[model samples]
Target: MATIGIVDTTFARFDMGSVALDEINKNASARTVRITVPGIKDLPVASKKLLEEQGCDIVIALGMPGSAEKDKMCANQASQGLIQAQLMTNKHIIEVFVHEDEAANEKELAQLMENRAREHAVNVVKLLYKPKKLIKEAGTGQRQGFEDVGPLGM
Candidate 1:
């Protein structure tokens, strides 16, 4: 069975990692390894370790950015690092980040986190076991947290 890695942040208000794990279990038979770090900046290293040292085929990096300027900058830096890590390892790291400001209230934030994590979990499964599924989705303007914008007829 393929091994999947999940790297999440303790700073997040919600438990996106658990939501992803549950979704992955429901969809595929892959083994999962999860690593929890202190913040978004820590995700790159943990994800790299999971792929390079833990025999993971693919990784899911989940983070939550707060509604602040510094938080947004930090999230951007983390994203660049994740991209670099993917390039270094020649593997895919499916990034799932939900900004706290995206939602109006706690309930909305919770739902956003769950939706994004659950959607990306399925993406991880597709990358491992059903790549063609993604091909069919290309340019479909699919959004994770809210409704998909749908493909603008090209």
Candidate 2:
């Protein structure tokens, strides 16, 4: 059985860690362990390293950066760190983040975060258990949270 690790940031209200675990359990037969950090900037590197050391086959990282440019900068830094962690461990880390301003309101933002987390959890399940299906589901030009956004009025 595969073991999945979940790392979530607490700066946002959404409980991405719980949602991810639920989604993973529903779609796959893997076990999950979760850890929640204080903020988005704290998520990527240490979480991945700790989970890898714990023998996790896959890691799911969740964070919510604020609307400020500083938050964006921090998120970018976190991403770079995650990339390095992936290289060092040769393990997959699924980064799932929903910005505070991704939506027009708090409710919309929560929905977006939930969607992103659940979708990525499906990705996590597919990565280890069903690689072929994942390949077929690829090739989309949509942004991170755009896949399930439905029709947008431009």
TM-score of each: 0.98, 0.89
**Tens-digit lDDT string for candidate 1 (107-151):** 999999999999999999999999999999999999998999998
**Candidate 2 lDDT over residue span 42-79, tens digit each:** 77665676666778898999999889999899989988
User: Over 4 Å off in model 1, which ranges?
Assistant: none
Off by over 4 Å in 2: 140-144, 147-154
lDDT to native, each model: 0.96, 0.83
Error of 2 at 147 (Å): 4.3
lDDT of model number 1: 0.96
